[model samples]
Target: MKRVFNKFLIQPKIVLSIFLLTSLIVLISALLEYNQSKKEINKLMENQSHTLLDAILISSNDAIKSYNLIKSEINQRLLNNAIFIKYLYENNLLTNSKLTQIAKENELFRINVFSKNGSRLFSSHPLSKFEQTFQNKSKEILKEIFNGEVDTLQIGIKESQLSNSYRYVVAVAAKDRSAIVINIDANKLVELRKESGFGPLLKKFTQNKNIIYLIFQNENGIIAASGNFKDLDDLNSSSFLQKSFNEEKFYSRIFETDSISVFESVNALIINNSKLGIIRLGLSTEPLDQIAQKIINRTIIQSIFLLVFGVITFSFLFIRQNYDSLSKKFRSIETYFKNIFDNVSDSIILFSNKLNIEAVNNSALELFNSKDKYELELNFNSFFVDLIKIDFTILEKEISINDQTKFLLISKTIFNDEAISNKFIFVIKDITHQKIIEKQNIRNQQLSALSDLSSSVAHEIRNPLNAIATITQQIGKDFTVNENENEFKQLTKIVYKEVKRINSIIESFLKFARPLPINTESFSLKEFFMQLKLQYQNIFNEKNILFNIQLNKDTQVKWDKFQIKQVFINLIENSIDAVNNNGTISVFAHEIDNKIEIKFSDTGKGIQEDILDKIFNIYFTTKNNGNGLGLSIVQKIINEHNGLINVTSKINNGTTFTLILPKVVEVKNV
Candidate 1:
C-alpha cells in the first residue's frame, strides 16, 4: 500500500492534471467576470444616455425660445421700416435718390412702391427684373395689410433665392390700396439666431467635452451647429433624424467611427405652439469605455496574481518532495533516445493508423526538408498515399514529393504499448540516385555493344559502296547510247545514284559508331547564339518562320563549340521541318545555380506522346527520309558535356526542349 501511494504521489502527470484543472477554473472565472462587467457597464451606459438625452432636450428648448424672441424682434423692426417707407411714398417725398438714400440708411436689401392699382411705379433699385413677380407674390400680404388685422403691418420670411440667401417681404397698406414693399436680408437674422440661441447654449451645455457635437435644424435646413460641423452636415439627411422629426419624439442611438463611440440623441424643439427644429447631440462614450477597460484590467491582474501564487506554492511543495528523482530519470531517458534518433541515417516517422503523425526524429525532419513535426503530420498524406494497411510486418513503396520523383522504400509496422495502441511506424529510405545510376549503367553497356557492331558493319559496307559507285560512273562515261539504248543509260545513272545513297548511309553509321573527339573551349553564349541566328536567317525566311533569342546576360561556358553548334543546328532543322508558314521559334538562355539552362521553344506540330520516348532509338524515324541519328547525336554530345536534356510537348500546341549544362568544366587528359 505504501509503495502504491508513493508511486501515485511521485507521478508528474497527477501534478500536470491538477495544474490544468486549476487553469480551467481560472479561465472560466475570468470569462464570467468579463461578461458580467460588460453587462453592468452596458446597463449603466444606457441609463446615462437617458439622462444625457433629457439634458439636451432642456437646453435645446431654451435655445428655441431665444430663437423665437429674436425672430419676433426682427419681424417688428422690418414692419416698422415698411410703414415708414409707405408714409414717404404716399407723400410723394420718395424720389429715386431719396429712396436709394433711405435704403442705404436703413441697410435694406431692396425697396419698392406700388400704385393704387397694385402696379409698381418706382423703386430704389431696378424693378423691371423682379417687379412683376414681386407684385404677384405680394397680393396675399397686401390683402392681409388692407384688412387691417390687429393694426400692425407684418413681414414674413420667404424661401431662399437662387443665391441661397433668405428673403423677407413686408407690405404696408395705404388708404388707396397702394403699398410699399421692402425686402430684408435674412442672413443677418440667421447670424443673430446662432449667436444668441443655439451657439451659446450648446457651448455652455457641452463644456464637458463628452457632448462632442450639437446641431439645431428646422424645415429650412441646418440653422445652428457646433463641434464637428462637417459630421453634423453629413447627418443632415440621416434616417434617424428624419424618423425623430416625423414622430415628433426624442430618439437615441449609438454611432461609432474608427476612433470614438458616440451616443446620439435627437429631439424635437417646440416653442410657441410650433416646432422650431430638431436638436441633435452626439455624446462621446469614452468614459464608459475607460470603465470597461479598468474592469477587464482589474480582473486580469487578480487572475494572474492567484495563478502565480498557486504555481509558486505547488512548485515549492513538489520540489521539496520529488525533484531530484524525477529530474535524474527524465534526463536519462531523454539522452538515451536523443542520441539514437540523431545518429540514425534513415528517417523514422511514427504515426497513428489514421495517418496522423505522432512523432518524428531529427532525420525524418531533415529528409522531408521540414522544420516542424506538425507540418509533416499535416502533409503526411501528400507525401504518401493509399497507405491503409498496417500489420506486424513492414511494407515498402515509392512516393514523390515537391515535384521531385524519388524512390522511397517505405515500411509500416504497428506500435502497441500502454501509452498508444494500433499506431503506425513508418521508416522511409530514399534510393532515387542509386536507381538512376543503375539505369545509366545498363544503357551505357547496351550503347557500347551497338556502337562496336555498327562500326564493323559500316566499315565493311563503305568499301563495296565506293567501288560500286565508281564502276557505274565509269561505265556511263565509257559507253555511247543511241535512242534505243537511252533506257540502258538511264539504268546506269540510277545504279550510280543508288550507290551514292548507300555510301551516305554507311558514312552516317560510321559517324554514329565513333563520334568526333570533343575539343573543349570557353566561348560567349551570346556571340555563339548570334552567329547561329545569322546562319539560320535564310532558312527561317524561306519557311516564313520567326526566330527569337533571349539572353539574360553574356555567359561563358566551357564546351566543345563544334559539337554544341551541331546539336543546335540539328534541333533547328527539325523545328523548321515541323513548322509551316508564320510559325515562331524562340531560344532563351540564363544561368541558375552555377548552371546554364537553355530552352528552345517552337510553335510547330509536336510529337505524339506514345512515340516521344522512342524517338532517340537507332533507325527510328517519323519522316520517310529521316535517318533518325540527329537527336541521338545531340543527346550524346550533351551527355558528354555532363548536361541534362528534357522535352515537353503537346500535339498541335508546340514543343520545348530544355538543356541544363554546367557553367564550368574540367577535362581530364585521356
Candidate 2:
C-alpha cells in the first residue's frame, strides 16, 4: 500500500515549481510596490511639469493673438485708405496729384493703381520711382487682385528695396477692373510683435527655483532665451532633441552636466501659424534624486533578503530533486519508448488477448492510409480476416488492395504488460517495393540464363533448318514430275513452308537472346495515345469496338519510344483479339509518385485466374495461331525500363493490365 501510494504521489518538479512560484510572487510583489511608489512620485512631478508647460503654451497663444490683432488693425486702416482712393477714382476726381495727396493724408508709404493688364494708371509716388521698371512694379505682388482672382489682397509687411525700412502693402479692385494699391511703414507693428513674443514667457518661467533654464531654439540658434539660460546640446548634434522636433512629440529626460542634473522637457513651438523652434525647459532634479536614494536603500535591503531566501529554498529543492531523479528517469525512459513506438517506420499495432485493437502507432495509421483509429481498426480486421489462421512464425505475406499487391513483413509477439495480462504486438513493414526489386533481380538472372540457352539452341536448330530448306529446294527442282506432279509440288511447298516457319521462329529467338539497345527521348504520352487512336481507327471501326483513351493529365516521360511502343502494341493486339464485336478497349494513364501508371482495360473474355500467372511465360499461348512470344517480349521490354506489370481479371467481366513504369528508364541487367 505504501509503495502504491508513493507511486501516485505528486512529483518533485511540481512541488519545487509551487515553492518557486510562491517565492517569485513575493519577489514580484516587493518589486511592484517599489515601482508603484516610484511611479507615484514621477506622476506628481509629471503633473507639475505638465502644468508649467501648459502655462508656457497659453502664454504663446496669447502672444499670437496679440500679434494677429495688431496686424488686423493695420490691415483695416490700409484697406479703408485704398477704398477711399478707389471712390475718388470712380468719381472721376482721381489724378496723379489726387493719388499723391491721398498718400500724404494717410501717411501711406506707397500707393499705385494698376489696370487689369498691370499697367499703372495712378500712383501716390512719383512715376520716376517706378520708371526703371515696366508699366508697374512687379505684378506678382498684387497678381491676385490684378488678375481678378480676388477683390482685395493684403501684400503685407515686405522690406523696402529702396530703404532699410519695411512696408505694409494692400491692393483692391476698382471700376473697370483696375486695381488700387496702398502701403504704410510697418516698423511700428514689427516692434509691437517683438514686445509680445516667446521671450517674455521664457523669462517668466526662469523665475521658478526648479527651472534651471528655458529657451526657444531652432536649427540656426536660440530664438528666445531666459537671462540665466544654460547652453547644452544643440539640435544638429542631439538626436534626442531632433526626435522630439521631427516627430512633434513631447519628451522629457534627465539632462546631466558636470555641475548638475536636470529633467528637461522638449517640444516644438508654434505661434501665429509659424513653427518658430523647439521649446526646451530644464528643471533641477535634486528632489527626485533625494527620494530615489531613499528608495534605492530600501530596495537593496529587500533584494538581499530575496537572494538569501532563494538560495536556501533552491538548496532544499536540489536535495529533494536528487531523491526524485530515479522516478523521473523511469518516466522519461517510458516516454522515450512511447515516442519511438509512434515514430518508427514499422507499423505497430497492439492487441489484447481477445484480439481487440488496444493501441496503434502513427505508422500503423499511415500504413493503412487511414485518418483515425476506428477506420484503421476496421481496415486491419478486414485486410487480415485470415489472421487466426496465420502461422505464428510466418514473417512475410502478400496482400492486394485495389488490384495492387503489397508484400508486408509481419512480426507478431506476445508480452505480459503491467495492466494487461497478455498483449499481442504486430510490427509490420510494407516491403512491396523491396519485393519488386528482389523479383526483378531473379527475373534478370533467369533471362540471362535463358539468353545463353537460346543462343545455343538457335545455332543447333538453324543449321538443320537451313540444310532441310536447301535439300527440299533441290528435290523440287531436280526430281522428275510424272502423272503425280501436282501432288509432288504440293508436298515440296509444305516442306518449304515448314522450313520458313522454323526459320522465322529461330530468328525471333535470336532477336530475344541479344541485348536490345534503347534510344531514350522525352515524349508526351497524351500525344502518343492520340496518335495510336488515329492510326488504329480503321481497325477499331471494323470491329465495332469502342476504343477510349482516358488520360488524367498530360504527362511527359523520358523513355525509349520504340520499346515502349512495342509494349503497348502487344497489349493492344491482345485486346483486339480478346474483344468481341461492340466491345470496349480503353487505355488510361496517370502519374503517381514520379512513376507513369498506364492501364489497358478491355471488355472481353478475361483470362482465367489459374493461367494468368503463366501468361507472360515464353511459348505460353491460349490462341492456336499465336507463337506466344508477344507477351514474353512485352514483359522483357517493361522490365528493361525498370517497370512492373500487373494483371487483374474476372472471367467474362474484363481484364486490365496495369504498368508501373519509371519516368526515366534505368540501365540494369534485364
Candidate 3:
C-alpha cells in the first residue's frame, strides 16, 4: 500500500501561485480603503466651513443695522435743534447769542440761517478771518424747505471738510421763505464703529492657516476681503456666485488642484432686505490628506501579515489531505486484490522455500479438507513423483486424499519479498470432475449398446416362447392319455408353467431396454416435507440422528413427485448409513431468483474429495448391499427437470448438497 502512494506527489507550484494571488487582493483592498477615508474627511471639513461662514453672515448683517440705527438718532437730534431755531427767529427773538449757545450745548458742528436766495443770513459764529462756509450742496434738498413745500428736511451722515469729523444735518422752513440748517459733529461715533464692527472679526478669522481665503464680493467689485485669494469671478460673470447671492443661503463645495485640495463655504449678506454681496471662505484639505495616508499605511501592513499567515496555513492543510487521499487509494487497490484471491476457484497457496505455507485462500483450505488454514502445510514435492521445482511449470497428476484418488493440475510462480527470499504462489486445480465426465461418456455409450442387445435378445426369445405356449394349449384341448393320466397332466402343466415364466422374464427385459417417461405435476414442497417426515422419522430415530426440515409453505415445483420422493429416500438412507448416534441431517428449501433451492446438510462421515466426482456414476456404490443406482437416478431426474446440483464436503465437517430447479418444467412425449 505504501508503494502505491509513491507515484503521486503534491505539487508546490500551485501553493506559490495562490499566495501571490492573495497578496494582490490585499493590496487592492488597501488602496480602496484609502480612497474612501479621504472622501469622508473632505466631506467633514466642508460642513465645518459652511457653519462658520453662516455665523459670519449673520453677524455682518447685525453690524450694518447697528450703524444705521446710530445715524438715525443723530439725524433726529439735529431736526429738533433746527426747528427750535426757526421758532425763535420767526417770532423776532433770533440773535447771535442764542445761535452760539445752541452750537455749544447741542454738540453741533455749526448752525447757519440761509435766506431764500441761498445767502447765509446768520451763523452760530462769525466767519473766521481766512475761512468761509458753503451752503447746503443739493438745492433740491433745500428747495422744499425754502419754497414752503415741506416744513423740514433730514440729511444723513456726511464727511466734514475736517479730516476726523462726520456730520448729521437737518433744515426747517423759516417764516420769510428762508431755511434754518443745523449739523452735529459725529467723529467719536465713527471711531466706536470702526473698533467693534464685523470687519475686524473677518480679519481675525482669516489669520488661521487652514482658512485659505475669505471674501465679500458683488457684481461691481470686492467689497471686502481677508487673505489673498487673487482670482475671483464677479457675481454676474460667475454662475455659482450669482446663484449663491440670489439664494441668500449658505453653499459649500470642494475643489482639487495639482498642488492642494480646498473646499469653499459661500453665503450672501442680506441687510434690511437688501443683498449686499456673497462671502466665499476657502478651507485647505492638507490635514485630512495626511490622516488618510496614515490609514492607508496601517491597512497595508495588517493585510501583508494576514497574507503570509494564510499561505502558511493553506500549505499545511493541503499536504495532509493529499497524503490521506493517496493512502485511501492504496487501501482500495489492496482490498480489490484480496477479494479476487479469496473467491477464485483454484486453490492458491503462498509458501516459502522450505514448503511452509505462509497464507492460503478459501479454495486451498477446501482442497486439503482443512478448517484451520495455519495447520496446513504445502506438499508440492510429495504430490508429484518427479523432482519438481517451484517454478513456472504446469503439471497434471493424480493425487490421493483420504484413500481416494483425484486428478490435479498444478502450477507455480515466484514473487519478490525481503522477508521471504523464495516466495512461491502455488496454484492447484481439481480436475477430477472433468475426468469422471469423460469416463461417464464412455460408460453411457456401453450402456446404450447393452440396452440394444437386450432388446434384440428379448425379441428373438419371445417368438419361440409364444410357439411353445400355443402347442401346449392344443395338447391340453385335443389329446388324452390311457395309463397314469394324473402324472401326464401334472408334467404338461409343469411345462406350460415353465414356458409362461420364461415369457415373463423376456417382457421384463423389454421394459428395462426402453426408458420410462416421467409424469410431472405441480406439488407443494411443504406437504411433501410433511409426508417425508412421517416416513423417515422412525428410521432416523433408530440411529438417534437429528433431522431438520425447513421450507416455505407456498413453495411449489413442477416435477415428477414420485421420482423426487425416491431421490429424497436415497439421500436420507445414505445419511443414515454414514452417521453414528447423535449425528445430524438438516434440509432447507426455498425459492430464490425465480428458482427452487434445496440444501441437504449432514454431520455424517463426509465424503472424501477424490470420491465426490464418482458418487453419481452408474454401478458406483460405496455401501454394502447397495446397487449404486440411487444417486445416478437422482442426477438423471434433476437433469430431466432442467435443474442443477452441486456438492461440497470436508472431512469430519459435513457435506452439503445444493439442488436448484426451475419453477416451470418442460414435459417430454410419453
Candidate with top TM-score is: 2
| Of candidates 3 and 2, the better by lDDT | 2
Worst 10 residues of 2 by lDDT: 128-137
- Give candidate 1 misplaced runs (Cα > 4 Å): 1-349, 359-383, 389-409, 429-441, 470-485, 525-555, 571-610, 644-660, 668-670
Ranking by lDDT: 2, 3, 1
Question: Is candidate 2 or 3 superior in TM-score?
Answer: 2
RMSD of candidates 1 onward, in order: 16.9, 10.3, 31.8
How close to the true structure is residue 453 of candidate 3, measured as C-alpha lDDT? 81
Better of 1 and 3 by TM-score: 1
> What does candidate 1's lDDT look like per residue over 1-670, in tens digits?
8689678876889989988899889879998989998888767766676677667776566766777877777777777887787677777677877778888998887887776456676678876445566677656656655455534455666655456777776667764666777777888767666665667877776677787877878767777767764534333467787788778876777777546678777877776668777887777888877888898899889899978987989777765665666678799999998888767888888767566776788888877777888877666655543564433255555554653446767777766868767776778777765654454444445556777888998888888888888888898889877675788888999999988888887777777888557679999999999999899898888888999999999998898899899999988988888887789999999999999989998899998989876665667789889888787787777777777776667688778887888898655434
The better-scoring model by TM-score among 1 and 2 is: 2
Q: Candidate 1 clashing pairs?
A: none
Residue 479 alpha-carbon offset, candidate 1, angstroms: 7.9
lDDT for each residue of candidate 2 in 557-656, tens digit (9 for 90 to 100): 9998988889888888899888967899999899999998888999999999899877877778999999878888887888878788777787898899
